[model samples]
Target: MSIAGQAVGLFAVTNVDDLLVLALFFGRGSDRRATWAVVAGQYLGFALILAAAVAAAFGASFLPSGVLPYLGLLPLALGVRAAVQAWRHPVDDEQPAERGGPRVLEVAAVTFANGGDNIGVYVPVFATAGPAGTTGYVAVFLVLVAVWLAAGRHLATRPAIARTLSRWGHVLLPLVLLGLGLAILLEGGAFGW
Candidate 1:
């Protein structure tokens, strides 16, 4: 796939749950300012996630390039972890007590909390890409953040759709993460598989 396509897929797969959360946030927001707070918070959280991923990627460069594929284990392990959590918790997307309160920091905190897997998946991918490719992915991902917000707000207006996604996302995310992990490992010829 093209770099932009890859970025979009990565963002969508990783952030699917976030979209639901964003919907909830918007759903709670009765004021225009509250809506903007959620948007700002999402951006702040996403920026930090990207920063951590980039930093990790830079650190990874010191390792032999051949070893990069081993880093795919990060996501593989996380996928297993998420699957276990989903199995145990079932409905993990509980509405936060704060209910997307107007605190920008609150939304950012939730965004960051949800992004642990994103950083894990992004690190090796970014490390593998050339500078131009990484930049392209980042650009694409940033743009998608807006798209996600708009989509989330739309979901907010439709409670039934939001609930369905909330119910199914936990089940699907694990599968997607597992697939992404295996694909990464295979692409890198990890363990000669």
Candidate 2:
């Protein structure tokens, strides 16, 4: 795929569910400052994710081709961890304060935690992309992140949408991660292990 295509594809796949999480955050009716902090934290966290992917992709050039696919295990492990957490906690245990509160670090932590699939998908894409392609992908991703935040904030005001997302979002996220991880492994031919 072209760099633009890759960026858009990656962003759409990795962030389709994030809109729900972002909407949940905005629905909290936190002060503007807190909302912006969450945005900043999200950007910071995503930057870190992209940086890691780029680094890994660059480094993978030195590793055997067969070994590169094993990198998918990182996301697989993360998905399992998230699934276990969701299973242990269940729906009722989630408090409103825990769900809606937006400390910068908390937002960053969640962004990073939820980004396992991003790393998995990005690493392979970046591995094939030259520096110019990587740059283009980064630019597109960064721009789309702002667009995503805006869309989430807009969605937050819709009571029906926000309520529905709040109710089921957490339950769905782990499953999405699991699917993404499996897809990554399959796409990378990591299952040969």
Per-model CA lDDT versus the true structure: 0.72, 0.69
- Summed backbone clashes in each candidate are 0, 0
lDDT of 1 by residue, 1-193 (tens): 9999999999999999777567656765547887889899899989977887887787843434466556556556655865796677655456522222345875675566457667878988999996888899899999999999999889866768546544565555456556656765786788998
Q: Which residue segments of model 2 deviate by more than 4 Å?
A: 60-100, 162-193
RMSD of each: 8.2, 5.7
Model 2 lDDT tens row, 36-155: 876987798788778878888888434344654555555456558656865776776455322434556645655655675677778888888878888999999999999998998888
Residue 60, candidate 1: alpha-carbon lDDT: 44
Q: After best superposition, candidate 1 residue 178: deviation in angstroms?
A: 23
Name the best candidate (by TM-score).
2
Q: Which candidate gets the maximum lDDT versus the true structure?
A: 1
- Per-model TM-score versus the true fold: 0.62, 0.64
